[model samples]
Target chain A: MDVYKNLDWEAVEKLKISSGSKIVLKRDLNFLRSEENISVQFLLDGEVKGSVDCHLCLDNKDIDENSRNYLYPYFTESMNILLGRLISTDPMLSALKIKLSPPKCTIYSKTIDSRLMSELVVYSLVINDFDFDVVLNLNLTVIN
Target chain B: MKEIIPLSELRILVVDDSDFSRSMILQILSEAGCQLVTETNSAEHAMKLIREKKPHIVIADIVMPEISGIELTTKINDNFDNIYVIMISSLSQEHVVLEAISSGASDFISKPVQKNQLIESIQKIAQNISKE
Candidate 1:
């Protein structure tokens, strides 16, 4: 699968987080797309309430390489760092409830690790600041 | 620098299907002072080792072929005693959470596994095991 479909530059531009706000990034595997979708949310007082989507793509060929070993982990850890940044920059999301779901898809490959999949979603949620009661509706497929 | 106890001294087993996940956990545990950490990519091997070695703790993924973490925990509890199992996964679904706990897991840690979170959870489990 071709990983990089297209960067949503418009979404990136729409980010309105202020300076020094805390951000939390999370990633969700869209079983429909066979791709990982990243979300960046802002955090305040350990709550995520606001977020922006940060989509990442990976080539199927890369999955064949040793480099793929770092793909999921790096994506996840980087998002965590970004979340820390959002927390420092914008704390407004501390009180708002946030909800997120993976793109619609019915059939998902179960060969992938669940933690890897969750890392993808968590990475997406790391960049934006949001509140505590936000609901993250995640859609996952178990492909055998 | 935090004066935390090292994990290397504790016997740890990492169970996951992916080489990357196993390696990542191994690295993290090693850095945390785990010295006798073993890695298994399949639940079958993991269960076999649990029955034989009886490590201090088992860090296992939830979804796997042959035997899932829930089943493994159940079998371990049925056959052995005093082995701590920590279920790790990306999904925080209520059903899975309940199953892991019901299956004799000490705790469930969500993924993507944060270094601090994993360390803290392991430390807590270790402390509990020591108390027993």
Candidate 2:
């Protein structure tokens, strides 16, 4: 089945917790070609491990600098905060001493509406497992 | 036939990844009577500027890309005997605080830094430097 052909962009957009938040539901045309998968996981309040995987597609021929600059910092800071929160809450995980294995970012380009669209893939992880029940909520704030 | 001031003139270098934070610190230092203030967005740039300008005090953010404030302070202390380093950070992590002190930071201040708090920290640095 062609997942990209039936992708509900609206539903994916609705799942976004913040204006800059990236959420991926399934693999797309881009994921199949790159042979890579992006995932971000956060453990909240000593339990409740949650993760998201992202797959992006772009034409790869024409990409712009503005889009790359805009996306890079946004993703980096959000992931840092998410990971920091997880580390702070989980004492057991802190003892296990998991550390971020440096972030990997890739850029690609695609032609959409006769214009080049740039896509970025960022993968991050946060690990924490405890017995307590917890709820996870994502919040993004504008830095001034 | 010259007037002597109670507080010596200070040349301060403020380093932070955030432009907003650097500007806030600069404004606070300026108001506190610091005559020369230099600002940099990263610790590497800050070290280069520090070597060139030879500022009396360096106020740096603890967490940054590439080199961190602690690393910067350690490098400065290794080469420069007279300069003072004050670390400013939003993080109050115990490990971070201990690392900053161990790395030769003269003091650490928590962020959302108020004008008075900044002035006090600088004053403390100035006084300590004068004693040494």
Candidate 3:
């Protein structure tokens, strides 16, 4: 069974609504070239083994201090909510035991090198007229 | 009528690696009339604070860098009595919840925690503490 197929898409839509953001699926990896990015990764164990990397695209915009304070935590919590919903709400996934490590955040001063990565998913979203991107790199194994 | 434990009287400690989560939890506790609340980003520091503050409830995130929340719960169970742990995490699989419960967590809460759920859990535990 395809793990992606079993994901709870309604959760994704809920995420957009809760964040008050409009999301567009981006086919290219251009979001990786942003000047600054916040990357949060979770380590999965149990029935699923691997890591899920969620990135927030914050380019060279002059964001104010208030925006920075709000956006960072908002983005982190959004990732947590999305991933938690993805695993716990899905019929197939909820039945299987899985552990997600605490999401770890890192800020990059340069563009991410996507050429070396495989199985990348990108979502470009606009929240309050400020553009942000969510990049997911799933390297997973589902134990039968 | 449900006996309302004055949240302000319950000393609580919240441990999470995410600044966002910690702040959100603190805000919730504050609004709910909780007065004594302490927070830490690492489980390592949480242990020291637990020793120092001796809070009635400890809200912990399951995932962390040095020591995971499960380990922390186990440690608390071993060394302390009546220190209820509320485990919070993004993963809600059956085994994960079971593991947390087995590790001595008084309650389990999923991440992006709902305010009512957290308060309810805390209230339940606080009431239990009052009984003992």
TM-score of each: 0.51, 0.51, 0.81
Model 1 lDDT at residue A119 = 22
lDDT at position B96, candidate 3: 82
Q: Which one is best on lDDT?
A: 3
Write one digit per residue (lDDT tens) for candidate 1, span A109-139: 2232334433233222222332211112222
Q: Which residue runs does candidate 1 get wrong by more than 4 Å?
A: A1-144, B1-6, B130-132
Residue-wise C-alpha lDDT for candidate 2, range A1-144, written one tens digit per residue: 222232233332212213234333333333223322222332222122223222233223233677545444344334444344334333433332222322233343322221222232222221121111111122211112
Native A-B contacts reproduced, model 2: 0.00
lDDT tens digits, residue span A27-121, model 3: 66453555578787888788878888887877777788888778876787667767776788777778888877766778665466566566766
Q: How many residue pairs of model 3 clash at the backbone?
A: 0
- Candidate 1 chain A — worst ten consecutive residues by lDDT sum? A1-10
Q: How far is candidate 2 from the true structure (C-alpha RMSD, Å)?
A: 13.0
Candidate 1 per-residue C-alpha lDDT over B1-132 given as tens digits, one digit per residue, 9 for 90 to 100: 234334656778898764545676787887787788888977789878876766888898775556777788898788788788889764454555777899999888765566788888888877645421
Tens-place lDDT per residue, model 2, B20-131, is 4566577677767777788988888887898799888899887676787888999999988888888976544556567789999888886556677778777766665542
Q: After superposition, how far is residue B70 of candidate 2 from its true place, in Å?
A: 1.6
Best by DockQ: 3
Query: For candidate 3, lDDT tens digit of each residue in B92-122?
Result: 8778899999999989998777789999999
Q: Name the 10 consecutive residues with the lowest summed lDDT in model 3 chain B.
A: B123-132
Query: How close to the true structure is residue B101 of candidate 1, measured as C-alpha lDDT?
Result: 94
Model 1 TM-score on a 0 to 1 scale = 0.51
